[model samples]
Target: MRPRFRRRNVASEGTESLGPSIPDGLWSKCPRCRELIYTREFERNHSVCPRCGYHARLTARQRIALIVDPESFVEWDAGLSPADPLQFVALGEPYPRKVAEAQERSGEREALVTGAATILGVPVGLAVAEFGFLGASMGSVFGEKFARAAERAAVEDRAFIVFASSGGARMHEGVFSLFQLPKTIVAVESLSERRLPFITVLVDPCYGGVTASFATVADLILAEPGAMIGFAGPRVIEQVTRQKLPAGFQSAEFLLQHGMIDAIVPRPRLREELAHYIRLLTNQHSASPVSFVTRQESDR
Candidate 1:
């Protein structure tokens, strides 16, 4: 039999770290509630803070498991890795070397994981961004993955859902990286032609070229509580405008008040929320939970 057991990861409680090298049985302090929580239990609750209901950041894999049906995710573009086409360097480290180090740390080839999955037995195309991978910055590859996810969803008549969590465009890649904004927008804009639903789930710290492009143009935009969403970082915007920004200017709740997004979804209810929207948009009635079965299984 294949070995199924894995080594333990030693991350602090309630924090999300899936790698086996992390130290185990550590406790984590909730940033919002200031309460100590067992790391294992925190993961069991899907990384949401039990005391104050704050949603913790999740790894790309953990995020995928939250909404997709068990064993139903078929990933695409997993081999795509970031390249230092510009031969860029920053902070005294070469860009390619930096990307290599980041890949090692995050256990992902790139920041985004694109795939087909079923949410509540309703097929949907999903793309989740991993923030731990170099702040989940969008490079050429990241944009390509996002674009292809939208295309796949459109072609398959499935709802397209993107989880956006980024610090912005990868500065290391320079202009080549920034240009992907338009590329992704073109891909996202194509979804409308098919009348497929496109949803953006804005996570923490979404800013820069990402917010200025495809992320803001979703058919329905949903943000997690306290997510910072804006075209620029608050400090930079304040400097440019030379004004004292209001408190929580770019927070998820703030965006909702300004009519920037459709709604603010709590972590616990996100699956239900997305399923509801997908069903209405697709005219799909309630589907019983159906696993992917082979022709032989069906015949049997």
Candidate 2:
């Protein structure tokens, strides 16, 4: 028999502690394992915890820096911004105002950031969504940019890669937003039509129309560990079906077990793993070891 338990938290009931605050975002607590992680080491480790191997959320710019070869990324459709055709208003802010605020705060015109870049000297079209921007919701601009990225990949004979992180289609856009689902599906279909390899990297909290569409229709679908990937959230699913979901349901690991995803990848190994797959599919030549040293010094 064990002794009766006493609460470890001394804080008052109905209140929560967010842990010790750190300046400049250098320290954080892991949600899964409750381990404290140093941000510098976390970034060096590609936002993965050295202790428990948990993957942390990353911004679009951070991802680009980690994945692409140095100075190789070129922006595509950099000037496009969403329009307020419906003039939506909510929470005392107009739709356009909200869009502007999100853009200013995130430093992106839309949630999606797309471009062409070389992965280990292999040309590929890259699109990464910023979940910091309005939950990375998909709007018409998001779909259009992805279509352009896919088309560019086909034209350049390069592989297409998209890092998907979204809550769903933008609710503020109404039916017009929903239309983007089929539109993006058609764009993804073009990749298949052109016989171009399309890979999707599903980030945390991928769901709704985006997940239901091109996100799942990839030649190879990979997800970061512990990412939430599903059509609807677990709570909604439970509410609708009135059944308890299996433990860890809708997680990237759960999806892999159910044959929904190809594999769970860590951020640090993503570039190498993706390049390996691309080379295998394209029959590209083997790459030399990466080095910035001169040939004479290397031979010596």
Candidate 3:
């Protein structure tokens, strides 16, 4: 008989350079309750903790798949890339290298992905944030993508929809990044002037510049269950005001009850709800046929 092939442990091959092992099959710790549960179980609940209802970060692809029609998405600005204007370096790595690493981890070149797709056959422009990219901070590329997406929507006369999830402006990009806040806001305003419907879906941990700008200006705002939407994070607010925040102060459900959000949408129902809105808006604005208008004029 041939020698029994032994299973070699490849886990240690990259250990020396890659550092210590992450606990395998460990559940994500709940930020609020500090409870540990299975990751698979958390995912099954749409990334919400069953114990304390903590929202977990979601990937751009996951959001896209959740919100867009299958086989319908066509991505935009896929070639746009970040530039190292400051030539900054930190932790033995250049800024550009860090950006590349973030992109690799997120499977996206920037924090946001802009695209066109239908939700239940209603055409709309979509922009989803990839939180894996340095907490989906707004930078030059992010701003460019948002502006371009808005312009595209205006040109196509399609509804503009954005899923905003970010920790705010990218610090590495400095003031240049902050400038994008107003820039994106202006683009959204232009869309508003055209009477186009702009919808925003707030995801967990949306704060900083993002909450103050384009996110707050949407014609209709829907937030994911258990998301946090605010200008400053709870920690910062606590430190600045020296006041303890109430439990679930910034949660999506809390905001919904307080009339801040139009609705608290669960992951599965997001597409259906968006489609209903799109169809309503499209029908409300659709022009009557030329023949019908001419017949009306003749009767008059």
Candidate 4:
């Protein structure tokens, strides 16, 4: 005779007495800490997980709002959208349709947004990448927008700032996507020739061509806490090299330790950090000569 076991039913076991199931949109789970947090609280904290301090990804508009002064952001290249130069199709889906879906989801014309804004009242040209749009892949339009943004910085005699949140080059556009690498590098070199300050904030999951080009050419390279920053992801690198990776590989903290980035900044402190560096590099707001020397040394 087998032992009889009763199967308890969660629905019929008076589970409703747990005071109503939590509403879906009211709470968010922290991926790092695995803790439930109030959604409003998470947003107020700039999307950082309170329990474990995981910096969550933000949309371009949200990032802009977080970094710039109130009503100070005036966007550039808003009308420029990517063209399917190769008439690309992937997985039974047309490239244009894929782009349209990304646009609808992100509410942006492209993956990158360039603009002029005041960070803590210091004027600067800003480019923010929207990961919500096709993983913020670099396309011809993305390159164009970035180049124009750098040019605007040169013209305005202001520091240029970029918030890079990308997966890599946009493959849908074919070789045209790869061409953006040199194009954007030329733009960065233009600023370098003019002795203008260029800064980049490497957000979570920044990788591939964007990382290879304009993103890392900035005079000041900053990153959000725990951001994954590398040319190739750990899994890919490990597989190709047939070697094990180190702990915290490609994370912001790891990069900081290796002297690859200037700082690992938390989301809430990012605006202040950017403003501080901008002022130091541009000799604004009475930035001292000592601080300028420190910045130069760090850049080297």
Q: TM-score each candidate.
A: 0.85, 0.85, 0.79, 0.87
Question: Candidate 3, residues 123-147: lDDT per residue as tens digits?
Answer: 8999999888988999999999999
Best by lDDT: 4
lDDT of each: 0.84, 0.84, 0.82, 0.85
lDDT of 2 by residue, 191-297 (tens): 78778789999998898988998898899999998888899877788899999888788889999999999989888899999898888887776757557677668
How many residue pairs clash in all the candidates, one count each?
7, 0, 0, 0
Q: Which residues of candidate 2, in runs, are more than 4 Å off?
A: 1-26, 287-300
**RMSD values, in order shown:** 9.5, 8.0, 10.5, 8.3
A best-first ranking of the candidates according to their TM-score comes to 4, 2, 1, 3
Model 4 segments more than 4 A misplaced: 1-23, 286-300
Worst 10 residues of 4 by lDDT: 1-10
> What is the lDDT, from 0 to 100, of the residue 150 in candidate 1?
91
**Which runs in model 3 stand beyond 4 Å of their true positions?**
1-55, 284-300
The TM-score measured for candidate 2 stands at 0.85
